[model samples]
Target: MSLPLNEQTVLVTGAGRGLGAAIAAAFAREGASVAVNYRNSGKAAENLASCLGGKASAFGADVRDGEAVAQMVANVKVRLGAPTTIVHNALADFSFNGDARSKLDALTWDEIAAHMETGVKGALNLIQAAAPSMRERGFGRIVLIGTNLFQNPVVPYHDYTAAKAALLSLTRTAAAELGPFGITVNMVSGGLLRTTDASSATPEAVFDLIAGSTPLRRVTTPEEMADAVLFFASPWSRAVTGQNLIVDGGLVFN
Candidate 1:
C-alpha cells in the first residue's frame, strides 16, 4: 500500500526514550498517528506522547511476550488505527561499554538468549501480529533496526551483535514471505550513534576516534538514522524490500 504519510499509523517499539523516541517523533512529524510502544519507560513514553500531541500515544508491553504484543497491537488499532507501519526499534537493555563487555569465550548461552528475546523474538511477535491486518488491507511496512557490526565488529559486543545478525536474516526471509501481501520488510542500521541511552557508557575518546574514522568526520545521530527508517515506511521505497541500508557515514561498506 502506497499510503500517504498522513494516512499511515505507525507502531514504534521501545519508543519511550533514546533512538526509539526519535523514530516515533519522526513519524509524528510526518503526520502519521504514532503508537509509541514502551516496555518499561512508561513515564518517559507518556511524556513523549504528550509532546507529540494527539496523533501519538504510549502503550507498554514486553515484546518478548507474544500475547502482550498481540494485545498491544489490538489497543493501537482501537486508539490510533491499526498500525500499517511497524518500526521494530526495541532493544534489550545493553550499554556500549566495549571495554567492559564479554568476549566470545566469556559469553554464555543465557547472555545470547537475552538479546535475541528482544531482537529476534520480539520482531517475530510484531510481524505475526501485524501480518493479518497488513494482508487484509494489502499494505504494510515493517522496518527492523540493525547494526553495522556484521561488517566491522568494532567492539566485542558478542551477544548483542549476534542477535542483530539474526535479525538481519529474518529481515530478508520475511521480506520474501510478505512481499506478495504488499508488505515491505527491510532493515536500517547505523554505526555507534553519537549519543543515546545505550551508547552513553562509551568513552568520549572512542566517539572521537570513530568520528575521525568516518568519511563524514562525525558520528551519526539517532534523529538522522530515524529519517532513514522513514524511507522504508514511505512510498518512495515502494520497490525496496529484503534489504539492509547502513546509515553510518562510510564506516563499513557492504
Candidate 2:
C-alpha cells in the first residue's frame, strides 16, 4: 500500500534556502515529516525547521560525499523515520547572471565536474543510502530537481545545464530499474524561477524578457514549482514514473 503524505518521511537536500527550502516547505505543508538537508547553512536550515513545526528537522550533509550522505540518512531514520521520499534539490554554488557566466572558450572541466558532483553523484549516493529501506517497504519516491535551461538554453549556462541533462538520463534508467519495487523516479524541471537566491543576480530586464515570451506572461516561482514536486510524491501520481514534468509557466513545452 502507498504511504500517505502524513506517514512519509521526506528528505530534501540543499534545503537551507531558496528553491530547496520552498520544496521542503511544500512537503511539510502536506503533513510529511521533512528532513531539511543543508551542507553549510545550518542556521538557516534550523530556522526553517522551527517554522515548519510538526516533525520537521535540520540535517547537515554534503550531498557530494557518499559516506556523509549515508550517515545522514541513518540519522534521519532515527530522528524522524525511514525516508520514503527524496527530493534531490541540491545545487552547486552558482549565480544566474548570463552576463557573467563562462563562455565555452573559458569553461573548464572542473567547472562542469562541480555541478556533476552534486547533481549526478549526489543522486547516486542518496539512492544507495535510502533505497534499501524503500525496497524493503516495497514503495519509494525519488524526485530530481532539474532545470529547463537544457531545453531552452536561452542563456546557455553550459556547466549547470549539462549536469541536469545527465540527471534526466539517470532519472529514466533508475525509474526502469526501481519501478518493479514500487519506487518511482521522476524529474521536475523548472525554468528560471523568480527571486531565488541564485536568480537574484538576474537583472530586472531579463525577467521581463522571459515573462513576455512565456505563454503565461510570467516567470515561474519557487513555491509554484515546489508544489509540482508534491504531485510526484503523492499517491495521485502512482501510475506516473520516469516522466519530466516541466513547471515553467508554459515557457518550455516539453
Candidate 3:
C-alpha cells in the first residue's frame, strides 16, 4: 500500500529517535519532504534525517513553547517547505520506569505541568501553525501519537496518561473544527512498543505481561505503529477523523 505523498511536506515532532524517527522515515519513503522536529537530540535527529534519503531537515524547538513552535514552523517552511501534514509525537521529560510509587505523593505540580505542556500544548501549537496552509490547500492530515494505556491502564503513568487522555479529546475537537477546512485529526495509540528510547525504561516483565496477554502474543514495533500513523496521514483517511486507532497487536479492541 503506497501512500501518494510525493511532493508533500510533513512535520513530525520528536523525530530525533524512537517512534518519531520511524514515522519520519515512513513518510520520507513515500517521497514526502519531512521536517524532523526535535527538542534536544540534535545529532540523533540529524542522523535520522540523513537516513531518510529524501528532502529532510531537522528543526529543534520545545514544542511546549508556542513562540518556539511558531519559529520552528517558519524555519520548516523556509528550509524544506510548508508542512501540509503534521504528526504530533513530542513528549516532555518523562521516564517510563520513573518512580511510580512517588508519583502520587512526591510528584510536583511542575512535573505534571511539564508533561501536559508538551503533549497537549505542543500538539495544539503544531495544529494552529500548520492548519492555515492545510486549509488553504484544502487538504491536511494531523495524526497524534497517543497511548493505548489510556484505555487500559496497565501502568501507573498518571501524568502521562492524563495528558494523553486530554490530547485525545483535543483530537476529536480538532477533527470537528478542522473538518470544514478539509483537515482531518486522528490519533494512533500503541502499547508496549518492542524497542524505543522512551520505552527503554520499561521493565522486561511489563513487556512480558502485555505481550502474553495480547492476542498476537507479542509486542509491536515502532515501525508497526508508524504504519498506522501513515494510514491516518495519507489520503486513504480523507473521510476519517476524530478517531483513535489503537495499534497494539489487538491488545485493546473497542
Candidate 4:
C-alpha cells in the first residue's frame, strides 16, 4: 500500500539522532504520531520532536532493559494510543572506526553479550510489550534494523555483525509467529550510510571503496533508508512479512 501514516502511532527506538532520527522524521512526515525514543540523547530527541510538531514526542528508555522498555511502551500507549508500528533500531554503543579490538581471541564474552543483548533482548521485550495491542487490533508493523556487513563479512565488527545477524533471524521468526495476529516483522539492512554520526569516523578511502563497489556508485543517505522502512510500516506491506530489504545501493544482491 501507499505511505499513509496519518493518525498512526509509531515508536522508533534509538531515535535521538542518526538513522533513527531520520526514520522518526519520515514517519512523522507521513502523518504518524511518533515517539522518539532515546537512551542518552534526550536533547536530540526533543529537538526532533519539535521539528515533527505536535505529532511527535520524546521518550527515554534503555531498550535492553526489559522494565524500561515496558514502561516506555506503556507511556507511549497512554499518551499516543496503542502504537501500531514499532521500529527496533536500538543498539549497544559500537564504534565504526575499527578502533576496538574485535578479534575473536581479543574480545571478551561480556563484549559479545553486550551487543547481542541490545539487539535480541531489546527486540523481544518491545514485541512482547506492544504485540498484545496489535493483536487486539489485528494490525501492526515491526521493523528491525540490521547491517549489510553480514553479507560480505569484510568489516570485522564481529560483535555488532553477529548481533545483527541474530536480529535478522529473530525478525523472520517473529514474522512467522505473528502472521496470524496481523503483525508483520521485517528487517531493513543497509551498508555504511553517508554522513551519519555512526559513519562520521569511517575513513574516507574506506567509504569511497564501498561507494565505488556499489552498482549505484554511491553511498546511501539515512533518508533513503528511512524510505524503505516507511514502506514496511505503511499499509501497502500488509501482505509482506518475514523479509529483509537491503538498502545499501545495490551493494549486495539477494
Count of backbone collisions within predicted model 3: 0
Ranking the candidates on lDDT from highest down gives: 2, 1, 4, 3
Query: Taking the tens digit of each residue's C-alpha lDDT, what string does model 3 give over 94-129?
Result: 667744433677767777777789999999888888
**Residues 180-229, model 2: lDDT tens digits:** 99999999999989989899999999999999999999999999999999
Report lDDT (Cα) of residue 217, candidate 3: 96
TM-score of 2: 0.99
Pairs that clash in candidate 2: none
Which residue pairs come into collision in candidate 1? none
Clashing residue pairs for model 4: 1-236
- How do the residues 68-177 of candidate 1 rate in per-residue lDDT, one tens digit apiece? 99999999999999999999999998999989898877879998999999999999999999899999999999999999987799886889999999999999999999
Clashes (N, CA, C under 3 Å) per candidate: 0, 0, 0, 1
* Model 2 CA deviation exceeding 4 Å by range: none
Q: What's the lDDT of the predicted structure labeled candidate 1? A: 0.95
| Cα displacement (Å) at residue 76, model 2 | 0.5
Better of 1 and 4 by TM-score: 1
Q: In candidate 3, which residue ranges exceed 4 Å CA deviation?
A: 1-3, 98-101
- Cα deviation of 60 in candidate 3 (Å)? 1.0
Q: Provide the lowest-lDDT 10-residue window in model 4.
A: 1-10
Candidate lDDT values, in order: 0.95, 0.96, 0.87, 0.90
Q: Write model 4 residue lDDT over 11-103, tens digit each, in one string.
A: 999999999999999998888999999999999999999999998899999988889989999999988888899999987887687765478
Question: What is the lDDT, from 0 to 100, of the residue 19 in candidate 4?
Answer: 94
